[model samples]
Target: MTEPQRLSRRLIEQVGCSRREAELYIEGGWVTVAGEVVDVPQFMVQDQPVALLEGAKAEAPEPVTLILHQGAQVDDRSALASITPASQAAEFDTGKRVLKGHFRRLQCLAPLQPGASGLQVFSQDWRTTRKLTVEFNKLEQEYLVEVTGTMRDGGLERLKRGITHKGVELPRVKCSWQNETHLRFALKAPEAGVFAQLCAAVGLTPLSMRRLRLGGVSMGKLPAGQWRYVTAQERF
Candidate 1:
């Protein structure tokens, strides 16, 4: 049988820490094996070792990918938590957590008022959470917008040139006018929470905004309150 290794070596080998750090960590009672605490740096070990560091057991959450058909009243909070079959909607509110984690300096997109709906894409990984590709930024987001007043000349031009709301300048949006009162827009930058910002710029209160397509993937008649996974070919 192979000779059993020392506790410090076992910790360093399994936990990917420096030998000196492992010794100190083991001596300080910060190492555990098989649910039994081992505080001796020189203690002999054999077999499989489950090395642990204090407060280090929390595994990073697995990354999830999915598309969300945002409802009129839905906000970032609701979108992040709304569950689907493909993705495990995190229980923790991402908006609230991001604010606290980022020293309260994070900006949030405005929420969709009651009755507006659209597609939203999101992920939980910190590294890729803010990536536009993950949230349909690269894909064309087609919106079915209903306006109370008729779209006069320069209305489409105004949308393409971008609009300012509350003194904040919003980027120009790509759109195709469907009719006198309806238009379809494809927003390039799909930030986490910018639906309300778009509405503000358009001078419309979002009487009703429905997400028709995300990243070339359309709802295609998925009725309200239902969702489906985007297949490989479906992704644009």
Candidate 2:
């Protein structure tokens, strides 16, 4: 019999996922061999049945990521909701069975306020999830915001520094006035309700807000309430 091999490599072969993903599972103590958790990627395993804990074993469908052009009208519905048959975006019906707790229960990384529509990136792929959520600070989310009302003196500078809202002091973001009524805001770490807070902090009443770009992805020409697959060549 051959000597044991690296647990991470063995897990990669068993799960058929990316090497990084396998390493993540192993390092997170999600991989088990013979009922023992294997947290070390370098652990040796020969013929033991490599088992992945429930949450760690989930795999997204082949296509992985789905890009939805959510509309400003359906503010009640999120981009992730488009995967449902009842959703107006019927094109998302790929007929692929995404196993339990797939994209259904998964909330979108960004929550678009009702009446504001724009591009949204979501995926059943764990890699995408990790990149979007865990490493979100590295990302920049672009938005077109239309507002009514004048700015508070130094509001633009304050917004650039960061607008303290609620109890916490929010992080700084890139903001510029596009026109008398339009403004462009690029948020790096988008905390919940940040868009609205930005408008409020700037002494502007938000008339409309639409996400134009998320990292390297853009809304492009896709009509609202519709969706398209993210091609393999594209990277966020």
Candidate 3:
């Protein structure tokens, strides 16, 4: 019987590839041990047939970004905890493989306020971080706010024209009624508590707020408490 050895070493000897290349193949889900796929390059193997899957490449894995539909009651920490492999949305059609590494070192950008829910960004890519952090003011965030009480005539027009709060002028935002009770707001880099303040200024009491879009990305058909990978086609 052959002695057990690291799968990376076995692949190097079997296919005459470099150690790094072997590790890449294994980590990319290209290697199988005894017909079972094993992603860990350090897995021990002895006298077992190891084969590389067809079309396997030695390219480095791409950094991943995830969009989660945070629940209204769940806080940011709990929303992050729901990002396990089991919580990946069934409708997620991105061909990207779900790996343990994808969840590590993820930075949350644009976290929702307490009691609010909708699209949230989590990224392992520095580009995504830079876009959301350094250029955040340039991105437009869309929210659907449910409110009670009646708005005075021209309240929405006043909101779109801008308002003064605490003697400071607030930036202009596009506000319109989505329905009798829901207002849609397209705001740019709105500060915390600004939504409630604006609603109050307009004589409306906000009951709930749910973010629907940020920049070019929209939370379309993503069920609550589940997450999906940001596809290459997605800009934000």
Candidate 4:
């Protein structure tokens, strides 16, 4: 039979708490072992799981992905890093309750340019993160591109042909004017700020680039500066 380990050691490893935190839990009578309260930090815990007291720190909730509608003025990192009730936008807030685990580890996919917005993904599920980066080339991205200047003759055609950047070839993309100012583009992007580069090659100066969709997911009017949980019904 295996010998017992220190209670504080077991709690810190299992609960994702620090040594100090484990000691606090023990001293505060917030932890239990074998259906009994164990308040000694060095108490030997047998091969049994530790449980927190009722109304104490609860079990980690299901992992979630968040979608944020960022404005041109906001930094993408800052936007997701600090989310608060007062900062949330839209008619409703992301209904998922924030958990201690959620804030612990965050993997970001589809890094957005400073001015770019819509459909950015932040996930706690490692599978979601893996799918996005490993299979990103296979996924198509849609953008609402705004530009200034008259499109040169054959400019649209050239835009479709794509350009060579830093010894790498960017493939052709589908482009159509949304109206007079907005151009809708669909492509597989390898890097951020791709729209601006493509636009400049075709005699148009980029004003702003708003990502409308990634893969099967669409931004769908998520208010700017606001975020919501990516539903299980949604893929990608």
- In model 1, the Cα lDDT at residue 179 comes to 72
Q: What's the lDDT for residue 108 in model 3?
A: 87
lDDT per residue (tens digit) for residues 63-170 in model 1: 333455566676767565554433423332232111111212222222233456765555443443454435634655667766554444575677788777779777
TM-score, every prediction: 0.44, 0.54, 0.89, 0.65
Steric collisions counted per model: 4, 0, 0, 0
Sorted by lDDT, highest first, which candidate order results? 3, 4, 2, 1
lDDT of 4 by residue, 1-236 (tens): 55789998988888798888777777655688887776677889778778878665423346667777766666656766765445545554545443334544666687665577666777888888899989877888888988898887887777688766556566689999999898988987537667777777667888888888888988888777777777888887
Q: Which candidate tops lDDT?
A: 3
Give the Å error, residue 236, model 4: 1.4
Residue range 1-236, candidate 2, lDDT tens digits: 66789998888888788888887777655788899876667889888888889876433224357677777776435445565424324454445433323344444655555566888776767777877877767777888889999899998899888778666677788889899999999877576567777888768888888888878877776667776656666677
- How accurate locally is residue 154 in candidate 3, as Cα lDDT from 0 to 100? 88
What would the per-residue lDDT of candidate 3 be over residues 1-236, giving only the tens digit for each residue? 99999999999999999999999999888899999888889899999999999999997678899999998888777778789989998988666777777887888897675678899999989999999999888889998899999998889888989888677677688988999999999988878877888888879999999899999999888998889998889996
TM-score of 2: 0.54
In candidate 3, the residue pairs with backbone N, CA or C atoms under 3 Å apart (3 or more residues apart, or in different chains) clash, namely none
Can you give the lDDT of residue 147 in candidate 2? 90
The count of residue-pair clashes in candidate 2 stands at 0
